[model samples]
Target: MTDVTLIFADLAGAAPLVMVLLGAAVFAMSRVSHDPRRMVRVLIAIGILLFVRLSFPLVIPLLLNDVIGAREVQVRVLWNALFYSVPNSIALGLLFWTIFDVGRARSAEEMTRA
Candidate 1:
């Protein structure tokens, strides 16, 4: 890939990072029960993880270009893809589950308050 492509990728990553920062700020300002706060924290974590995970692929081309054999590059990319995908899927899934289950927590809180 050209340097121009790398520049574009870098530019693309900025917005998500900004959004994640904004989410962090919102999380800080939130006043909620412990369980709801936990859900917000998980959401913030997922956002940061997403920004890092998506931005990571850009590093490979810059780091490995002409540094190794094609076969080695393939192996590394495969390993990176596996390393990249599985953990992200697991984390994202769990975070989404937490977000979905927030209603249960809210309902329990309501029950206690009543």
Candidate 2:
């Protein structure tokens, strides 16, 4: 098989694992907040991962074309799709969390004023 195909296959196989981790992180953040610091750290880590993963599929093929040779085209396309979809999904989740947190804090502040 071509190198690109191999790269695509590897990412496809690994995507589900990443999804599981992301899902677990989301669930943990939503359900457990006894320790806000711990949850924040987890969210930050996941955010960074999401950012990095988003770039990989798009950047890898362009940067590694020489090394990837025959596999470049297919792998690049696959990476583009995977990176765009997965990381964006996670990023959206994180954004939603931030919005919710902000709303909660604002409500609490208003309650305190009352």
Candidate 1's TM-score = 0.49
Question: What ranges in model 1 sit over 4 Å off?
Answer: 1-21, 28-37, 40-44, 47-58, 62-77, 100-114
lDDT of 1 by residue, 17-64 (tens): 657756754674464345566656576656656655566557555545
TM-score of each: 0.49, 0.42
Global Cα lDDT for candidate 1: 0.62
Report lDDT (Cα) of residue 15, candidate 1. 70
Model 1 lDDT, residue 54, Cα: 63
- Over 68-98, each residue of candidate 2 has an lDDT whose tens digit, in order, gives 5435567767755775677666765765676
The Cα error of candidate 2 at residue 40, in Å, is 1.3
- Assess each prediction's global lDDT (C-alpha) against the native: 0.62, 0.63
Of the candidates shown, which would achieve the greatest TM-score relative to the real structure?
1
Instruction: State the weakest 10-residue window (summed lDDT) of model 1.
Output: 62-71
Best by lDDT: 2
